[model samples]
Target: MAYSEKVIEHYTNPRNVGSFAKGEDNVGTGVVGAPECGDVMKLQLKINPENGVIEDAKFKTFGCGSAIASSSYVTELVKGKHIEEAMTIKNTVIVKELNLPPVKIHCSVLAEDAIKAAITDWKSHQTPASAQEPRKAQES
Candidate 1:
């Protein structure tokens, strides 16, 4: 399959290609695998607790060029964005941005899934009372 120029650029020079220490408190990690193609990706985000903003991102992907490009692009997209805003990034946007063909759509889906998974993991680690107090107060 022919990749678009942007995809090639990202694939060739992927950004944030490393990992944080396992116990790093501010880091959130998401790992996803695509059984259809046996592709695996691990994505991580370092969030600012006070503002819920992503201060940094990293990824390791074992997949096709499209998958690598998708993950790389997503990391860049989410940096400096609030976690909720980052969650709004859809697979369609990745596909459009990467100019991925129909066959490569799944790669974009994996990227989106990875983002949500990381966010979920991050939320899970947060103190329940602290995480929920704002919402509870709003509802009451």
Candidate 2:
């Protein structure tokens, strides 16, 4: 099977490939694996709590060229996007961008899952806005 130029470009020179600190308050992480192909992907995001925008994104993928490209592409897509916007991203976008064949479509799906999982993990760490307000002193 031949790979598209975009796929080759990303596979050879993938971007945003690294990890944030394990427990940073603003960092969210997602790790997902594909059983059929034995591909594992880890995606992370550093979010700005004030505005819910992703400040940075990073990913590590262990699989074929398509999987790596998909992971690499999604990292770029999510950065600077709101968490809700990131959640709406679908695997089809990755497939189209990388020109992945039908068989490799699952790779894009894995990338999509990674994004949702990371967002979910981030939400888990957040408290309701009302809970953060300072308490006033009671009248004596």
Candidate 3:
């Protein structure tokens, strides 16, 4: 199957392709595998605890170009975004952004899942008191 230009670019020069040390207080990691294609993806984020913003992101994906592109693009999307804001990212956005074809949709889904999983892992590390605190109200 043919790949989109964005996919090609990402596959050739993926962004943030590395890992953070485990057990870092500010780092969260998510690992997921696609049973259908035997593909695996690991995504990690370094978050700013005080403001809940993602300061950096990294990903390693073993799959087709679509999967690599999806992971790469998502890392970029999550950077500089608040945890809550990053959680809203959907697979459709990845599909659109990478011009992923129908069969490659699962790659985008994997990316979305990775984002949520990482966020969940990060939240799990938060102190109960801090986790329980009410979030700042969003201005309309």
Segments in model 1 whose C-alpha atoms lie over 4 Å from true places: 128-140
CA error at residue 124 for candidate 1, angstroms: 0.6
Error of 3 at 133 (Å): 21
C-alpha RMSD of each candidate structure in angstroms: 6.2, 7.0, 7.2
- Report the backbone clash tally of model 2: 0
lDDT of model number 3: 0.92
lDDT, candidate 2, equals 0.91
lDDT of 3 by residue, 2-100 (tens): 999999999999999999986677888899999999999999999999999999999999998999999999999999999999999999999999999
The alpha-carbon lDDT assigned to residue 10 of candidate 1 equals 97
Residue 122, model 3, lDDT? 85
Please give the TM-score that candidate 2 achieves against the real structure: 0.90
Which residue pairs collide, candidate 1?
A: none
Error of 1 at 9 (Å): 0.6
lDDT of 2 by residue, 1-140 (tens): 99999999999999999998776778888999999999999999999989999999999999999999999999999999999999999999999999999999999999999999999877766767522432221101
Best to worst by lDDT, what's the order?
Answer: 3, 1, 2
